[model samples]
Target: MANQSKIKVCVAGATGWAGSELAKAIAVSGELELVAAISRQHAGKSLNEVLDIAGTKIPVFATIEEALTVPCDVLVEYTKPGVAKHHILTAIAKGVNVVVGTSGLSDEDYEEIGIKAAAHQQSVLAVGNFAISVVLLNKFAEMAARYMSNWEIIDYASAGKIDAPSGSARELAYRLSQVKKQELQVSMEHTQGVKETRGADINGTRVHSLRLPGFVISLEAIFGMPDEKLTLKHEAGNSSKPYVTGAFLAIKKVGSFTGLKRGLDSVID
Candidate 1:
């Protein structure tokens, strides 16, 4: 059995945007050791050269399978949405806990992962959006949902982002669903033929997705009443560094979780 005192960690998609940042965070974390790093394009490179850390030569493998050749207590995934599920399942099947920051996983996907984790008695912690601002925004949005009705969400991101409406929007939708039922009234009085701008429907909330070149992730929950309207919004910039601390916290806490857990709020006080 691996010593619980120090967790040996492996990072998947280690050369990508968030992956690189997670590598750097784990390298300096002290409590977790960077045992292996996986990046198909940058295999065999030293971690020092890949992330420019001094005196560290943790070798990078071309794939997670190769990285798994070495022992690890946990697997941290920062890969794209399409690949995240497989990586997480692989890690859980291998008896390693997981800390996931990858986006785009559906609720059913998470449920399936939860079932697998429960059967194996393993732990899987997934975060749709790891930034603290996003977490607080979700909290505020849920609170607003409790008091406000006829609310809608507008989710914005870069054009290159694969998923529409975002995982964050879906998370917000799930949270709002838990708080209360929001009744949406669509105005039947249509002006000329402007119909397509109504946005997508998630559960019961209307979620509109905006993808532009300069936009980082941004989401606004707008609520309207008889005389007043309230707006709750959150914006994220280029650097994903804000998510590092939350991801680290998830890594430390996931080991205690018995099955799949969603959202940073679940594990955090």
Candidate 2:
């Protein structure tokens, strides 16, 4: 791609584990340019000092407001839920497209963001899990939902992760809900066990979340029939490479959309 066609990107959580990886990815990509790196903790530092990327001189900003002033075409946010929501809305208001990798946003949250993006005629692509395999896992789970009525979700993450029922699990539940209703052995209201023991009831699917020290990010969709069971699972490694490619894809395609687009599948096509 030519320099004029290169997409200018600002990374919101630029000093974070995932955010730093995204910054490096954009810095080295021919189709993208790293315009600003935003992190409150590392504000006023050069990208080289913050991210350790040699030879690059991108300045770090303390907040999205300061970063947006640099004229960016896209904002890729990998911050916490509260911060990510604010950054996304602000980016849209400025007519800058967004690619969201941060999880924990509810479906209703995305709906409101969609309205804002549409009003500003900007694009926002919000994805729970950006690994291509995870996208396929959700697709396969949706297909299984049509044939199998009984299913549950399991989301696994490190103990440090803040969100419960991981965003991937929530997105999976929503997708499965759209395809078919889960078969219930008993009504949730009349269940014998403690209400909390039933896990989270997300769109009729029981989603169980597990947070432990030894786990990275993983999700499983287990489908059960009269005499058979099928489990679809995807596990991430220690690296963030799995998410980088998908993020880049979103950055490249987000400008084509005018409202919020959920899931990597939207951009996959």
Top TM-score prediction, candidate number: 2
Query: For this target, which candidate reaches the highest lDDT against the unseen true structure?
Result: 2
Decoy 2 TM-score against native:
0.97
* Residues 72-188 of candidate 2: C-alpha lDDT, one tens digit per residue: 999998989888899999999988999998889898999999999999999999888889999999888888888886999999999999989788898889888888776688878
Report the lDDT tens digits of candidate 1 across residue range 54-81. Answer: 6557889877777888899889987777
TM-score of each: 0.91, 0.97
Model 1 accuracy (lDDT, Cα): 0.83
lDDT (CA) per prediction: 0.83, 0.89
How many backbone clashes are present in model 2? 0
Which pairs clash inside model 2?
none
Query: What's the TM for model 1?
Result: 0.91
What pairs collide in candidate 1? none
Worst 10 residues of 2 by lDDT: 48-57
